[model samples]
Target chain A: MKEKEQMKNKTGYIMLLIVLGLYGILYFVHAGKTLQALEATFGVFKTVAPILLVVFFLMAFLNTFIDEKSVAKHLGDDSGFKGWFIALFGGVLSHGPGYIWYPMLQELRKKGALDGLIVAFLYARSIKLPWLPLMISYFGLTFTVVLTFYVLVGAFVQGIFAGKIMNEAKKDR
Target chain B: MPRNVQRLKETSLQTFKTLQSIAPMLFAVMGLVGIFETFVTPEMIHKIFNAHAIHDMLLATTAGAVSVGQPFLSYIIGGELLDEGISMYAVTAFILSFVTLGIIQIPLEFSIFGARFTIVRNLLSFLFAIVIAYMTTLSTSFLSGYFS
Candidate 1:
């Protein structure tokens, strides 16, 4: 197990180095365009990255505070409506690029978040905040109402189905 | 209760350890993204999305698939789309996919969840992204009592 982890770490590091090296080359090759892009990207990171980092840290810290047993006690399979609602809301409320959220979601699953709930959250991410206003401005009240209702409903249905399928599949395993 | 304190301490330590383990890679990736950001341009993005309806949606999805950006970037691009007379559907598709999908991380996802599962999930997400955007537009139009 120790050797396996060491191997994974080495592979991860190599991948990181390769990616970094490529970016370095790109940055230098088209310094002018790259600088503009970098400024825009940095402009983006300045606002979003700090919030994401804080969330990541809080999640990491919180995950440790709640063991599988406790998570199971609160959010386990049979916890029913309340548990499901929490999972769904938690998933919807969480933010970040989907890539960044992947590891955290994996951690949540390990900590006993139901498969359906996880799926629901992933689905809910498709909904955006700024778009809500734009959506309201463009689409208006009735359509927005129905659409929001449909998304929330779809998220729940998808989550539950995903959970069921995974469990069933796991049983065969 | 005493047991709970011990568990809490153990969990805290584990959390710290995991963050410590991943911190280097995380910072490295963020730094790379910062570096890459310096290179993008509106014309570059415009070239990627163009103006054809079907092509624009495909381009939006494809762009959303490859790039990572904050919600603000989506709004900025969205405003540009409106100004440029790009279809609302296309812009919406791009925004939806931008946050929910990752084209560049397919390999990583494949490694973590097996290729078959990862591909199917993303394919499903991408398909649903269009639907969600369409619905958002349709609803927005209905609520405003005007075609948008």
Candidate 2:
């Protein structure tokens, strides 16, 4: 397992090198655009920094305080309706770049969280509480409410699909 | 050391390790995202939709999947498209996918979650974006008529 993880890290380094190589080539061909891209990259890092900090802190808290058995009880295979509800609402309440949550989700998965609940959480992020007012202003109350409702339902449906397929795949592996 | 302090130290070390493990992929993802965002503009997305309902929805969903942004930004873009006479189906799919899908972050997600899980989750999300968009449009219209 450690060897496999090391190999994955190596692949990530290779990918980073390839991106840097492309930027190096682009610098000569389109210096301005390459510079703009670099700036955007910095902006992304800046935006994600605080989110990453919070996520890491949460991970640490979970690691220190929360046991695997507890995680399994709440979000594992048999967690049922309550687990799904937590994931769906948790996704809605989560704020920031969705990618930032990947590591936290990974931690949960390691602790026995269900794939379906993870999918539910990710899909349910579509209904942003902070943006509902803005969405309503542009699309009106009916449209906003209906769209949000569908997104929640769609999330649940997709979660079920993910759970079934992922569990089967796990069994096969 | 006290028990609580020992736990705190362990937590900090664990956090650091996790950060170290994910750093390379995270940086690579950010680099790719920056390049994609710098090159792809909202106007470029706008030009892709031709106002054909089904065709536009597919294109919009594809566009949204490839591109990433905040939900608020998607709403603004969706509203602009709607005003420009794009079908509600197209705009809705675009908005839904824009938030739910992240093609740029695939590498990071793949590295963290493994290939099968990442692929399945993303595929499901992609399909659901279109389905929900269709449902949202139909339901919204019905609700609007009922309320009016």
Note the Cα lDDT for every prediction shown: 0.65, 0.89
Off by over 4 Å in 1: A1-4, A32-65, A95-101, A126-150, A168-172, B1-6, B49-53, B105-117, B146-148
Indicate the worst ten consecutive residues by lDDT in candidate 1 chain A: A3-12
Put down candidate 2 lDDT per residue, A29-143, tens digits, no spaces: 9899989999999998998999899998899888888889999999997899999999999999998888899888989999999999999999998888988899999999998
In order, the candidates keep a fraction of the true contacts of 0.33, 0.78
Per-residue error (Å), model 1, residue A26: 2.0
- lDDT per residue as tens, model 1, B69-90: 6555665776687678888778
Interface RMSD of 1: 4.0
- Candidate 2, position B54, lDDT: 93
Best by TM-score: 2
CAPRI-style docking class of model 2 based on DockQ: medium
Residues A27-53 of candidate 1: C-alpha lDDT, one tens digit per residue: 678766656655655575576566666
| Best model number under DockQ | 2
